[model samples]
Target: MRLNQFISHHSKYSRREADRLIEEGRVNIEKNKADFNTVLEVGQRVFIDGKYLKAQNQDLYTVIVYHKPKGEIVSKKDDRDRRIVYDTLGAKYAHFISVGRLDFASEGLLLLTDSKNVARQLMQSDLEREYILKIKGSVTKEMIEAMEKGLSLQNATLGAHHKSKIKAMDFAPFLKYEVTKEGTNFSRLKVSITEGKNRELRRFFAYFKREVVDLRRVRYGWIELNALPVGKIRFLNKTEYKLLHQFLSKNDKNFYVSKKYI
Candidate 1:
């Protein structure tokens, strides 16, 4: 990994902070001052301020589930000065990396981990995400067709962030969907999809001229929100950890879990 990423993954420093440390000549790799672009190899020894930054025990890591509430950005710091997930997570979890993101207007089960590798794995995996949505207007056949057959839009920015440069997007077929409440003014439905593209659900509904009034994720892979209250966090239970261990073992040949996690 790059020096900045190595520091960020193993220490409390952010990638930007790691770069600053390198610039200040406080970081060294094998007794030589490291640059921002330095890439570390296996068994490399890193020192910061003459103190060794021990390599992580790949078998040991922690994962937490946070019922992220609406109105909070999933970032370390926001230029807009809005509330961020760390504000609620507190300093104790300041270094944890979020697996994926629940947009500012969306809420529900969010995974965070102290291991950057774990976070990257989960985020990039094609795990099913289940959501309950309350949308404007009834579910139409057109929407159902798109959900079932998949969709591709060249101007897929309707429900995306204003600063997003992603104008085109290809959507995979939804895993499943069920309409629980149908009405002209609003409708409620539960849907599952494997991809976690930017504002994907919102963009899909927007294509049908429907607005998602409320969106909440209830499940991701084997993990569920269950009865977790809004804005609270809990460590992954033993069962979840076991499942995670199985998944990691399958995906990464080098990955190992401590017996405690199994």
Candidate 2:
């Protein structure tokens, strides 16, 4: 495997971060400085500085649909000691890494998996993630159209942002959303994004100064968070598992990072 892939597969860092470390001569393979093109083989000794290199194995490729509460932050560990989603998850998931982040104030569905490969694949693409959000503002039909056209918020154009974020997202499909509740104070909306961005939903509404009252992810890829009570989690069913594989397989990639220890 490439050095960058090795670093990411091990869960120590991302592929991009791995490149920088290798360039800085911080990573050593068999006690020598490593390069990005270096290939990692089985049973090879690796050391980060003088310490033993941790093998990237979170154990068992398990994907869980977590009903993250509104207050929980989507982090492996929270330094602030506030309530975290992992706090409800038992020690089995202690090593599990979150796939994507749902803002601390947002509540909804999130994917947590032990397999870094799967997480990377889903998060890296705009693979049809859905959300149900409640916004606090008055937005008419025309405003929604403007949203489809993309609006200027925080002085940055969000529609153009989507254009760039999802270069191939167009091929994937248009985002599907349903306005569940259109209220003068708290308007509830179900929005979909083929390409999920960090705080993209909130940012889109921010252009209209529509504060998000609540945001929850209802679906990702083919997995649904339905009936998964808040602070609860369940493994992806057989159908759910197959659907995800099919979704990822369609996306073109140079490599499919295989599971190391399963």
Alpha carbon lDDT of each predicted model: 0.92, 0.70
lDDT of 2: 0.70
Query: Which whole-number lDDT from 0 to 100 does residue 28 have in model 2?
Result: 91
Write one digit per residue (lDDT tens) for candidate 2, span 1-262: 7777877677546678778878888889888788877998888877766666677543346788888888887775678788877778877787577888887888777888877767877888766788887788666765567646654343434323343443221122235657777777888877777765656666667556677777788888678888889998888887676666666556635434334321
Q: Ten residues in a row with the worst lDDT in model 1?
A: 253-262
Q: How many clashes show up in model 2?
A: 3
Per residue, candidate 1 scores C-alpha lDDT tens digits across 153-180 of 9999888889989899999999999999
Q: CA shift at 168, candidate 1, in angstroms?
A: 0.6
Report per-prediction Cα RMSD to one decimal.
2.0, 5.9
Residue pairs in steric clash, candidate 2? 10-56, 126-194, 126-195
Clashing pairs in 1: none
Please identify model 2 stretches exceeding 4 Å from their true place.
1-8, 11-42, 45-60, 152-174, 252-262
